[model samples]
Target: MSAEAVSALGLLGRVELPGVAGSICTARRYVRGVLRRSGQRDTYDAELLVSELVSNAVRHSESGRAGGLVTVAVANCGESVQIAVTDSGSATCAPRIPPGQDEGAEGGRGLWLVRELSLSWGWHEGAAGRIVWFRLARR
Candidate 1:
């Protein structure tokens, strides 16, 4: 599933939260509940990816500002789970790997991990904000 997953998959789990640091854990727990309700037991990877994306949205996007917000959605495709995180637009930022980033650094590998762990991932930018999403094969 790709962008079509958003519509084709029919978002089963969705949440809106203040773009605060602690929301990362809240988003993870929410996803776990979504997965649990769907009868999926292995939730570690999905939770980790949601955490990274939420962290990025809160840390790098304008959503981090006072009164800002972020939205998370999860869709269950037949054989895969698609998750998306949308944040208020950032004037100076969109998703990307840091240029010439050090491989041994302690951080800055969130998107890298998403790219590696997800089956397929992409983003869509609209007037409201940009939504970055990843699809994971069901286990």
Candidate 2:
């Protein structure tokens, strides 16, 4: 993490959720509230990004085996906000843009939207699991 990244955003809130479908929505709202109060105008984008990250953790990771918790952390820098969603699974799969777009498709495209909307984004391997993080500049 860059000093610029850390200094800009304060620790707004941290949440731990069971790896379940419903938890994704809960995490999304939690993060959205943090950003909204931190003066973030792009609530929709933030919500979508948080949803995608949490959804991935819940659906892809092996649930109940060793148990898992989806951790959502929001930081508000003066100029931008950073959100990190961490999971307790070692799945090293990185998010990517889905090739081609089908209007009828029901999956993919989360990371694509994150890249398009966020000013900066990346992931890091942590001891507990992987952390997928994104930053949006205040507009």
Candidate 3:
């Protein structure tokens, strides 16, 4: 399915996870199960993309506040699936590919993998939080 179709379907489920690393795998599994039940063959790829987005939110956003929330939303339109992760952070840093020498580093490759795997991905600031989202074709 095409991404444009998925966006038109709107969000299927929206979940909030605490700012903890363990929550990331749980969120990925939840998204995978949803896509799988929907007969999406690209469930694994969608899980991967969601993992990147959720991990970034958990790692970068400030936690412990009453309003701190990491939100995950999934949607499908028969042709494609879209996943978005939002956090209550105003930080302006954007994901980027590191230089050649940094390529061999131990970390900082999540967004790069998302770019390589997803049909399309981007980020924007919403009224309540910042959202990073990715879309995949449904096969």
Candidate 4:
């Protein structure tokens, strides 16, 4: 969904996490806790995608800098669940997948993995910042 179109329908929960390595763990835990409360058993892909997205926000967006934060919104999308990560805008960068994968590189597989694991995913820059989102079909 577009950054401005972040849906509130069936919203399960949301959390604003500090842009730090530690926040990745927090994001995962938050997702797990929320999903568990909703009785979602297959959380593997959701957890992994959330980690990847949150990590990218921390590394590439302005979120990683001091005082910066990432906002993660989780919601139910009928047959699937939606997860969106929003970070402070970065003038030099926006979300994208490399034309080719460099398996030998130390990083850069985040969005590609998101594409593979989620049912639908896209990103957009908004008035406030950037929002990257994905939906995993519920099992």
Candidate 5:
């Protein structure tokens, strides 16, 4: 885990990772590390959810560029954990429960997975960029 993960206190943990495809794994590792250090249980699903969100940011948003950035904020807010990924996306496209994707479709299931796994999810524009967030209840 990086130093920021520990320093960004007040809501469990937070980390800012590069907005690139390769950074997805790093983000996941950071999530796992924070959860473990904080003694939060059942991180597998949270890890998966973070993976999907980061993947979407890298693939569809401007954050994938060389100098682009993505910020992942994780917070343990009582019975549930809140995770948010802010990217340098151009448009403020809100995430939705996507319609049934085609069998032949190459991609487009990331948000769908988030919808299915998270207790609740949403997106909004922020000063930095677009933010996609989700929450999962502790089991």
Candidate 6:
């Protein structure tokens, strides 16, 4: 559905989370509730994608700094689910899949997993902040 339609229909729900490591789980729980209420069957993959997005925001953005917050939005548009995570922007970088992977590293695979699971994904710099979003086809 169109962004305007999603908002107009009130199909969207959002939660603001502390930009801390532990908030990842909280974001997942909040998304779980939204997905369940919308009767989404692919909750597991959606939750995982949300976690990765939030984790990336918390780990890489200014949001992870003191007193910052991350905002997560879930939109259920009947045939698909849209999830977006907004973070305090970083002056040094934007959200992107890494150019390559170091299998030996302890992390940095999150976005790759997101790409694998999401039907479509993208990010944009907006008036509110930097937002990364993904959509999954309903089961």
- Computed on alpha carbons, the lDDT of every model, listed in order, comes to 0.87, 0.75, 0.74, 0.87, 0.79, 0.84
Top-down lDDT ranking:
1, 4, 6, 5, 2, 3
Best by lDDT: 1
Tens-place lDDT digits, model 5, residues 61-94: 8898888888888876677778888888766455
Worst 10 residues of 1 by lDDT: 1-10
Best-performing candidate as measured by TM-score: 4
Candidate 6 lDDT over 77-131, as tens digits, reads 5678888898988999887678778888888888888888888888887766888
Q: What shift in Å separates residue 1 of candidate 4 from its native position after superposition?
A: 6.1
User: What is the Cα-based lDDT of residue 97 in candidate 5?
Assistant: 58
- Candidate 2 has its poorest 10 consecutive residues by lDDT at 1-10
Could you give me the TM-score of model 4 versus the true structure?
0.92
How many pairs collide in each candidate, listed in order? 0, 4, 2, 0, 0, 0
Local accuracy of candidate 2 as per-residue lDDT tens digits, 4-97: 4444566777778888888878987897777777667668888888998888878766532346678888886668778888776545455567
Rank order (by TM-score, best first): 4, 1, 6, 5, 3, 2
| Residue 94 shift from truth in candidate 6, angstroms | 1.4
Clashing pairs in 2: 8-77, 9-76, 9-77, 10-76
- The worst-scoring run of ten residues by lDDT in candidate 5 lies at 1-10
For model 1 the TM-score comes to 0.91
Error of 2 at 133 (Å): 0.7
Reference-based lDDT, residue 48, model 6: 93
User: Residue 87: error of model 6 in Å?
Assistant: 0.5
Better of 2 and 5 by TM-score: 5
Residue pairs with clashing backbones, model 1:
none
lDDT of 3 by residue, 52-107 (tens): 77777777765324446687878874577778787876455655655553766787
For all predictions, the C-alpha RMSD in Å is 2.3, 3.0, 3.7, 1.8, 4.3, 2.2
Model 1, C-alpha of 50: deviation from truth (Å): 0.6
